[model samples]
Target: MSPDTAPSAARVDPKLLRIAFILVLGTFMATVDATIVSVGIDTLAGEFGASVAEIQWVSTAYLLAVVAAVPASGWLADRFGGRRTWLAAVGVFLLGSALCALAWSATSLIVFRVVQGLGGGLLPATGQALLARIAGPDRTGRVISIVAVVPLLSPVLGPLVGGAILGTASWPWLFLVNLPIGLVAMLLARRHVPAVPPSERRTAFDLRGAALLSPGLAVLVFGLTEVSHGRTLPAAAGVSAGLAMLAGFAVHGLRTRRTPLVDPRLFAQPPFGAAALALLVLGASVFGTMFLLPLYFQTGRGLSAGEAGLLLAPQGLGAAAGSVLVNRTIDKVAPRALVVTGIVLILVGTVPFTQLGHRPTDALIASALVVRGVGMAMVSAPVMNIVYSRIEPAHLPRAAGALNLLNTVGGSIGTAALAVVLQNRLTARGPDIAQAFADTFWWVLGLCLLAAAGATRLPRTHVGKS
Candidate 1:
């Protein structure tokens, strides 16, 4: 049996499993693409004879485009059907990838990346919505738990994959690599991904809400990115404008007759409200640590990028194990219990990093990372299972959009905030760079606790109830 079918193949329909396999292929491609390019920025800059600042737009433009495009995904899936929308996204992504590979200059490459991001951004939330509608509530846990492994592994795998490509092939192959995976996914999707009819609710698209929300998210992420780079004035202007626009969208969502792009009201709903908050913080903690760890390994420990990536591999292994555990136990366990336990494990895992000043052994660091990875899988899968299971089928698309948006933005904010914290500590602590990382990890511990507190509001009982 394939790894994709593991833990509960007999319990899930074989067809659903096949659909999930295709969905994950696209998701893995998009998620990995986000980070894969980071390792190549220097190479890209050298090739184009551009400065680092100029080449950086290659990554930044893609991120902004993704943020702008995510809000529209729910409407697209509802207006046109999930399968069709998904296929279109894959097509667009493939086109962008090809364009990126053939780019004549840095400017062209950055623009092509934006085209890629538009499609890539829509993938995860839309795919989740489609899968949830097909699996229904009772089985969402098992299937989603299995599907969740892709993103969990992507952070560690991305840099490693990119490094390998750069070692063996030219940089264009980085983008070109997506073509084969995308084409296979598209072909499989058409054959196995059944077309669901569009929603009958006939409400017109919310252009005003889209105007406010999409640009608002994009600008906000840009601001946070600026914050990480220590550009104060631009960050301030972008963040303030983004927040103001988001507030306007919230007011618009509450008062509008037609549905808003992503309903702000969804965040106020019961277990969902709690789940959203948990995921928001979880995003921060997960992405924040991911941001910090590679730097820590390279600068503080003097490891090469490949060695840092290899050290990170244990976390992926742990998450894979945790995913299998969640697949088996999600139905049997209360969400609150699982999430709280997961947070505690995360706390345990992070403890070693906080003691980095002492220079812990490699074995200890690897073990802690494995524990952290397991904790992450545990927290994320259960939160998703609860939300997907409880929500009405019609709301899945928008809800998925909102949830993913929060997680994405939360990651940005967390990474930026931690970057600031790490920078401050590095300066204040002087040559004790390891100690500075240790201090920054305490903040990560605090984020885990915040998520744990949010988990307390989740359903205390099993999520199998109608």
Candidate 2:
């Protein structure tokens, strides 16, 4: 079970490829929805006659649901079988999308979005697990590389698509678009996904562990969101409560030792531990940049949301390019080297943003995004390949789920932290918020550098193996 020891390469099955593609489609819808509403906020506000504060719930509710539901994905998949659970998740997502499209008020939209988030949260974690299970070790990197395209494209595309739809159609068209995509995915998945027998399934649900973890995550996320909005005391309280709950969950998991919502013991392995830490730092830096860029485009440059999205396209394209390149060489490259290199690229990419002036041109920002995208692409697939390559096959599902959960938490923390920083700097510096953004970019640069430093600690190969 060494990193370099080749697992038996299963025959490439066209059916499995089709299933993976179908799963990617579902993931695309989910990830796209997470940000599509960004550009549509104004329209949604006008349509619902709601204030900005009220409309913010749409995003908050969806994110909370994502955090709440993500930890359960592995248990559900093991309990019900991946194929069945995945299909059901997609169904729920589509239903939520439809409901979102039909909603008449902000409240209804928020409610529907929670439903959407519940389904959406499962897609990434389970999709990765399913692909790993089906592809086996030899092809896992390549398969995940293909799947990586969804997240890479969806965020940049969200506002672009939303802008186009809003320009010609309506805001509702954002959610409406998911319908056809979801329906087609449902058909493809039903036709191609292999069904595992329920008799072979693990029956345990680990309800007690979930009860502890989910609420803790929810409270923490809510607090972080509040901090982003400039409410310090409530944010502090929420974070404190969340930490306490997390501690309690950890104790419970260790004391009981049966499968917990998250198996804390996975971190005992050096590779897994280092990779998770790297993922956390990388997630914070990467997602922090994502949140910052939109503000830079819209607020600093006075560009429209659509324009910002188009400018952001280079990052996504770069990521896609990186995924392809890294996947090709993943088996050959040292994971540590690739990760460190990726972090360096991220640092290089982010430096350009720190130099932006009041009237930074579209071309300038676009170039920076391209560089950032390239850095992201470099890091994503290799980190994944490294993690999966090192862990035991039987632990893939839970490991993947936990990795994904960490990613979510990291992104949330990054978003909230960066948001708070941006807000504070903007308020404190007054008209100098543009400079403030540059300062924040410096912090992002430092974070990337720290990630690189951490990545160096990853063994040249998985421990206990060649």
Candidate 3:
């Protein structure tokens, strides 16, 4: 069978399932590691005898490094082949984890996190490209739907798992826990992951574009974070510089005869454009809420980290249910229909959060989270399926890279923006933190509506059909 199309089988191929399972191991490790360490921030500060500000670099460094590395994933996969690139990425991540476990100080740990982020950033996009290529358009929706849940669920699970580990063992166990899962993934990948040949028309690496795009994205994320922290001057400088660099890259991408890092022109295509917009908004709504809820639980409700994590479990469960639903209906349903419906569900779930001033019951909150989780699963899988199915097999790498980059940036901005709003509201309405959170949730509702608007532009037919 040609790589572009495969015969639709009654059941998903067992071989494809094995490959996706292996790839998910790597992605889950990367995603989970990002959030897991968040739980240990105070513990890390005490362990290293550093101030909270300094200890924060451990997470910030990882984030900036991830942003910087994302754009190059497509090029690396094209140059090195997907299997080689993925294995190498997993190896690098494990190396970083080991180094982090051995670090003697906050500075050293932060530096090592950068190494891990570079590897971690590449896994999701590269893995998606590889799976899509193997599954072909016909099976892409089902294969991706099944595997996507791991990384999606990781953010919620990370804090819970991190709390458990820290409660039982010392902080080193936080990093060390990755060792077993990663080792198993690497071994399984070596044996089961098939090699994908590099693109035939390998253009020269776009060094100039890389300099502009990668740093632009990193600095932009840094700026947004600073804005969240209310660092006005530094945030302004960072945001300005980042925007200038990105503008430079966009102009260069249009003019350059050589294949730019990620073609600016790809977004002009109808399906790709709408799907990208939807993903961008979805990222903002989902991650912004993630940033908001934890603070709400800990500060407003006076719950412990473990308690908050436990309460958030319903969202993960809902996501699992949504994935099962999408996997079954994706082939029969239009992308626009699924995505729009998902947005509606998200809005319904989010409505309760906007009523925090009433002191909504824990049961009410958990039910809302379940609805929100299912909605998220619905949006992500369909948007991704649309992109993977519409693009040619060879373009998968860059396309995947662009989508991931947008989503990451969107999340960063959304979290930062919401943080700023929450801060302002708290300052304005002094003793009423509940009302502040309620005010902030209205913004999340706005994002979901915006996503719904974009979904209207998504392909109206079954994307899996050639």
lDDT of candidate 1 over 196-292, digit per residue (tens): 6677785689999998999998888888778878899999999999999999999999999887888877888888899999999988988789889
Model 2 scores a C-alpha lDDT of 0.79
> What local lDDT does model 1 show for residue 320?
96
Clash list (residue pairs), candidate 3: none
Listed in order, each prediction's TM-score against the native is: 0.96, 0.94, 0.98
Per residue, candidate 2 scores C-alpha lDDT tens digits across 382-431 of 77877775665656767888888887788778788888878877887788
lDDT of 3 by residue, 1-466 (tens): 5444556652578988999999998889888887899889999999999999889889889988888888999999999998899999999999999999999999999999999999999988999899888888889999988887776687799899999999999999999999898899989988987788899988899999999999998888888789878899999999999999999999999999999998999999988888889888888898788778988999999999999999988989999999999999988888888999999999999999999989999999999999998998899999999999888888999999999888877777788789889999999879999999999999999999989988899888885444
lDDT of all predictions: 0.88, 0.79, 0.89
For model 2, the stretches where C-alpha displacement exceeds 4 angstroms are: 1-7, 10-16, 197-203, 358-361, 462-465
Best by TM-score: 3
What CA RMSD would you report for each candidate? 3.2, 3.0, 1.3
TM for candidate 2 is: 0.94
Q: At residue 371, what lDDT does model 2 achieve?
A: 74
lDDT ranking, best first: 3, 1, 2
Instruction: Count backbone overlaps in model 2.
Output: 0
